[model samples]
Target: MAALYVLLAMILVVLLSPLLTPFNTSTQFSDAIALPPSWVESGNMNYLFGTDDLGRDMLSRLLIGGLYSLGLPILMVAVSSLIGMSIGALAGIDRTIKYQSLSRLFDTLLSIPSFLMALIIIAILGTGFNNVAFAITLSLIPQFIFVTRNAVHEEWHKDYVTASRLNGCSKAYLLYRVILPNVTPTLVMQLTVSLSVAIMDIAALSFLGLGIQAPTPEWGSMLARSLDEVYLSPWSMVLPGITLFITIMAINIVGDSLRRALKERVNS
Candidate 1:
């Protein structure tokens, strides 16, 4: 719980810091180019994390970049979960030939690595935040579909579901009123895990020049831009890398904790 609180605080900082900070993320101060972290006497305290090659404030960029890095994945997961849950629920309740075919189609999509699928989709859709989010959502939908389908299938056979059927409940009523509620905990857990993967995928695409474009403060693009300045100002690269690492780790910890809690409740 302490870890979760700390993680939430970090997320709030990332999401809100740009608005709170005075520095402009895009404005370049020529004097501050490639400066190391502010702790060094030569560096300016104004730029706490340091300045990039173009003299953009590292801290400011990170905070602004959070809007993209964090925002896109969250949107992607939500859209994916909605589509996945709908299809999965239908398949789980119906068990028809059409649903089975849809399951096989999801399996086929799953066989391809999500990053690879995103690349392929991006190749067709061109590049932008919306396109990237759509691509990531496409890649993620299959996992949610599988998870929700399996969870719903298991819940469908439970004693409560059987009792509901015996009471002359319609399939729609059972699905919406009973099965979905029972399977929701598992779905929530899957959503958390998927969010972490979505972040990594978004970053990878940006690193490959297929995601958010240059001059943007996205962590992946920041890393890409910092490569040439690695010897001169390594902190530029390290800061964004650390930011990404910590954010993902915190999300995973929270997700895992929730999963354990859910399991314990179920067992009890």
Candidate 2:
């Protein structure tokens, strides 16, 4: 519950961060360059978290960056889940040669680490927000495919599914209405894992200079930019690092809680 609240609050702050601050991400305040947090001796209350080397408000940038950090991954996971689950369900229900080939392909892709796969795709596509998003989303899809396919396949072979099918339930009905419910707990677990993967992948890409570009204030990019001024303004690095850690930790906790709840539900 606490993790859920944190996640929700983070989402709200990021989504409304633009309105929350008087400054835009790139807006520079020449007078306040490298100021410390307001609590610091020389700090100004006007900039709650202080300013970067470029005089950009750290709070504003961090808040805005969260949109890319968490928001984009949320979107990426959703897209991957939809496409992967559809293909996985079809493959689960039908043992056609084409589906078998696709399963092999999925396995092959999954064998390669997801970051490596995204790097290969990004290398081929070249770097940009669209390309990175595409690369990451594609990398994410196979895991969903593997999980959903196996889950559906396992459920399909179960007695309940056989009884449903024998009672004239259509394949579509069985896949959607019957198998889907039973497999949801597994899928939910996978969803949390996928979200963490998406977040790290995107951040790693940006940190490596292969994803979001400069002036965008992405958390990963912000951290990368802060490295140069680490000694001068340690808070710059600390702020984004802590934010990323907290966000990921919150997500993991929430995921764990949900899994425990679902497990208890099953046991009961």
Candidate 3:
């Protein structure tokens, strides 16, 4: 619960950061280049977190960067979950040769490392916001597909499902109304975990220069930009790295709690 509250507070800060800070994330203050964190006596309170190599406020950049860093992954996860779940559910219902073949294809994709898969996809599609999201979605879809397919397959074999079928429930009705409901908790847990993976992937891609481009306030790009000045202003890199770490950790904690709660409910 404490983690949840902290996560919510972080999210609110990210959303309202622009309003909270007067510093322009893009504008560089020549006089404040490589400034240490404020409260160090030499640092200006105006740039509380300090300035980067280009004199951009680290706090302002981190807050604004988080908007893109967090937003894209959420969008990617939602899209992948929708498409993967639908396809997985359908394949789970139909054990036809074609569907089985599609399942095998997803398995093949899953065999590849996600980061490598993303890199391959970026190579083909080139780099951009949509492309990066699409790449991450592609990389993540297999997990959702595998989870949903297995869950639905299990639910389909249950006594309740058989009872429903005996009551003249149509295939579609059995899938949507019966199996889907039973599998939803598992799917929700999968989504939470996937969201965390998506966040990491987005940061990785951006760090590799395949994602959100320069001058943009993205956490990964910020980390990449700060590398040259690490010896001078380590906080620039540390701030974004810590932000990513905390956000991912908080999300994983929530995901774990959710999984436990769902498992308890199932046991009950």
Model 2 root-mean-square deviation: 1.1
Please give the CA lDDT of all the candidate structures: 0.87, 0.91, 0.87
**Candidate 3 TM-score versus the reference:** 0.93
Q: What is the lDDT of residue 15 in candidate 2?
A: 84
TM-score-based ranking, best first? 2, 1, 3
The model with the greatest TM-score is 2
lDDT of 2 by residue, 190-254 (tens): 89989999999899999999999888988899889999999999999999999999999999999
Runs of candidate 1 with Cα error greater than 4 angstroms are none
Question: Quick one: best lDDT, which candidate?
Answer: 2
RMSD of each: 1.6, 1.1, 1.7
- By lDDT, rank the candidates, best first: 2, 1, 3
